[model samples]
Target: MASKQHRLTGTQSAIYLIISITLNALGNGITVSLNLGSALWTASAVNLSHLVGGDLKLLLMLIGFIAIIVNMILLGGIQWRRAINNLVFMIPFSILVGYSATMFNQWHLDNLPLVLRIVLDLFGIVMIATAVSIYQRVNILLHPLDDFMQIIRFKFFKGNAPIAMWVSFIPPVTMSLIAIFISHRIYAINIGTIFSLLFQGSLVGWADRHVFKTLKHQGLDKLMTAKHQ
Candidate 1:
């Protein structure tokens, strides 16, 4: 009974992976193409690009590697399996985000009015939050940063998703601030960012309760129990 609830089969894992990754890409694509405001971490990377003079792709990849390091710290040891899974997820997800951004740009989403773009940005955040909820529960492969959030949620915050997510923002928020201080310019910080900062994690928590309520977090037992591995 409990095993059945916790078990996610091969087919189920594949299905959830496809759905979550696609949704996440589309959501992030909307923000990147529209140039409105991205989720905090991505925004921080963009802001830092102003000062660092590197490809956005490279910066994002670097940010992901940093996430793995942070995840290692959170887990209290180096978990190579999780780190490799994160990289595997990151590569494909990054590809999808790039292609989706190109498609959105081709569709002229970037031309929308500020008001409409703002609305779309909020909607994009919704999609992202929902994607995070789905993939976290799927527990197959996750974005390292999302993994970081999950670790925080269960490990420190007693499974409080909102507070965990808010805490996870500290590093990226610091990156953005440092970049802004050095560059004297902003890359992506707007109403949409404010909305995400205030509500993205809450959105994730809401999705956990309201969207696909039957999907248990597969593999959570090992994750939450393994003190250092």
Candidate 2:
């Protein structure tokens, strides 16, 4: 019952991809603004930005490019098209993150009480996990961080989203920890970060099963083929 992936036409898939991207950016914006925590990758970028003191969006894009190299290593070869696509994916995503964060900052989300912020942060994580589920299934082009999970999920875990998601988190968590060690201060690791580490994988798995159940993972055979190349 869970294995059959519903097919989406090209247009349908594109629409889903767009929706997921927007949802992801909005969630990221909220989490970053609230300072309650963020998805691991976003947290890593944020902590690194505090240290580096540059544009958050550009820093995120740089981190995204680095992730592309890691993804290539996982795939066992350079996937030029996939790499290029992943790079392109960052442009709109980073812009959206910047805009969303700006909008939320105007709303003063960070000024809210701790309990309210925590609840909103958790909701933001849900949006991010849902976005990951939708876009990974679309499999057209992907954010490199999510692409890492997709490769691990299908190539190593045989479509086990939870395991793959957990596996994918290791790098970002390490990145965040290193920033903390160097700065001797906490930046982005907070309640939301803890929530994501514990529940994000399971959340993605649940979303894959329930959110847009018709949109099955696309190009799995090609991914399998990429494994040997």
Please report the candidate that would top lDDT against the real structure: 1
What's the lDDT for candidate 1? 0.86
lDDT of 2 by residue, 119-193 (tens): 898999999999988988888779988898888888889788778888888888887788888987777788999
CA lDDT for candidate 2? 0.84
What TM-score does candidate 1 get on C-alpha atoms? 0.93
What's the lDDT for all of these models?
0.86, 0.84
Per-residue error for 132 in candidate 2, Å, reads 0.6
TM-score per candidate, chains pooled: 0.93, 0.89
